[model samples]
Target: MQPIDKILRNYQSMIVSGAIILFCVIALIFAVIPSVQKIQEMFVQVSDIAAEAEGLQKKLNVLNALDEQTLRFQLASVLTAVPGDRSFPSLFETVEGVAARTGVVVQQMGLSGGTTLATPSAAKLSAADRKLGARTVPFSVTVNGSISAVQEFITLAPNVRRLLRIRTFAIAFPPDERPLTVSIEMDAFYEPLPTSLGTAKTILPELTAADNEIIERLGNMELITQSAEALPEPFIGQIKPNPFVP
Candidate 1:
């Protein structure tokens, strides 16, 4: 056997052996790594399920302890009470009735809201601007009638549909008015009925095409803001899309 030949043969054997060992190692790693990862994933999934099951069990135990009356009340609170359909028309008729019965001449039953203002004082002004609710549509009813009639209307105002707060009421008797008429500017508050109010949208405004678009935008914006507000502070950060990932 020659030295050079022996050296080359030894090197070839080393290469072959190394290749076989490398193949065996790669095969073993591929086989074991998946099972290990699968076991880990299974453990994670089981842990999450167990935690959820434990929480549900605790909740079930608490619910079992609640009395029937309490549960009913809770159910009632969770379930929105169905409102009557006669709410708007009934309100209008009631107001008209008060005017007629009290002998008050309703010069205008104006509503001002959403950047629109009318002579009947139908200014589509928000309650916040008019200082009613944080966000609400308010109307100012101007009436020309006897002082007695105005007083009667004011007195009967507390019974209006929905919770109406008389924000502003003033009586003015002009110097040259006939029949000793008094001009009454009274503020009547009403919620601009929402689509999904869990109650009902109270004020039904007849909007033009542009006005309708504005109103819808406002409603959508309000919904988004409300949904955003309901989330935790940490969720606020989640709103802006994560730039790092697709």
Candidate 2:
């Protein structure tokens, strides 16, 4: 009947529809947006977990390719050659065995200094150089035999239970009927113990082709597997007096 009342009646349905739309927009902003964000975060977490699982699978594949025996042997070689302890007596024992195998008499032996760090020369570096963060203990040894025996000893040096670097090597020939004398300045290197390395750690890498070659050579070398029964009795001998002492 009145103009204002007629307008209100005509627009009431439209106003109700607008109010419903507004409520839906508010719900989209507050509730729907947060639910969408949570879904996105869950997808991201699943992707990260998948990537980590893939990485672990790759590592397992690499490990699975190697047999238990070969792995054990490789580990043994690493431990025996690059032990964590000072193990000076073991070095002496090893050299003694080598000399005996080469048919050389140990004329003199000298031990000095604990392990010390040094930058390795590029020419002398090998595959293990990068893998092992080790230190060297310096020593010298003198033996006497024929030239052939000396050559054999040098050739077999790699088979020692500890890795050796020959710093100085010399030979002398006596005037009379006697064996040739050989002198070797050597260093025995050992890996630092884990407790002493502070934050550092060693992770043995997957063996490369070059590494496999070295391992094969080590396996073929007679001295690599030389039995203690084959070695001569431990010789009670003396080390040359330290020149620095006097």
Top candidate on TM-score is 2
RMSD of each: 16.1, 10.6
Residue 48 miss distance in model 2 (angstroms): 1.0
How many clashes in each structure? 14, 0
Q: Model 2, clash count?
A: 0
Q: List residue ranges in candidate 2 displaced over 4 A.
A: 1-10, 58-66, 84-86, 116-133, 145-151, 159-162, 170-181, 192-205, 224-246
For model 1 the TM-score comes to 0.37
The residue-by-residue lDDT of candidate 2 on 102-219, one tens digit each, is: 8889999997544333423312433444444445667889999998999988877755656777778899999987999999988787654332222212233677899878766655
For 1-246, candidate 1 gives per-residue lDDT tens digits of 599888878798888889999998997799878889999999999999998777667766655676857534332321111111112333344456667766877776755434333422333445465453333334566677766767776765544332234667666666775533443333333333232323222232333788546434433321100111111122222454664442
Off by over 4 Å in 1: 1-28, 46-88, 98-107, 114-135, 144-152, 174-246
Q: What range of 10 consecutive residues in model 1 has the weakest lDDT sum? A: 222-231
- Candidate 1 local distance difference test against the native: 0.49
Error of 2 at 192 (Å): 5.8
